[model samples]
Target: MAEFWERYAEININDRQRKVLNKLLVADPDDFEGGISNKKHISMTNASSATATRDLKTPVETRMLVQSGGGRKARYGIDWVGITS
Candidate 1:
């Protein structure tokens, strides 16, 4: 958690984005069987599909999250290497 905040300290993250990221940060591996997806983000934040996509994109752009696959198969996992805590 400290690492995450410190890493993104200079970036602007809104409430919904913060909530989703924080959840991902502390979540157990078992909690995300296939990692996080657009559907998962929507469910977690009650945000629209577009909103979820946009929110998820930021972390990926900042290298805080790593993406796998493409399109519907796409999933996101925390960039453990990037966090380095």
Candidate 2:
């Protein structure tokens, strides 16, 4: 996981994005269905809801994170295979 994180550093992600990814990496796979939400991100990163939303987008777009649900109920989880492979 450390190696994977180190590899990601070359990309243009922000500190919040890195923090979110680290959280996802350690989270249980069973919890992924109802995974981390934007509100959680806001709390974790101490950023605004809008900032959390934007921070999440880059990982989703890059396929490092997988998004589910929609709107206020949206949740996110790490793409394990995408990261490990």
Best by lDDT: 1
lDDT of 2 by residue, 1-85 (tens): 8756765666789888888888778767775447889998998999998999999998888777789999999998876674563
- The worst-scoring run of ten residues by lDDT in candidate 2 lies at 76-85
Estimate the lDDT of model 1: 0.85
- In candidate 2, which residue pairs get closer than 3 Å at backbone N, Cα or C atoms, i.e. clash? none
Task: Give the lDDT of residue 40 in candidate 2.
Answer: 88
- Candidate 2 lands at a TM-score of 0.81
Count of residue pairs whose backbone atoms collide, per candidate: 0, 0
Candidate 2: regions farther than 4 A off: 6-9, 28-33, 82-85
* lDDT minimum window of 10 residues, candidate 1: 76-85
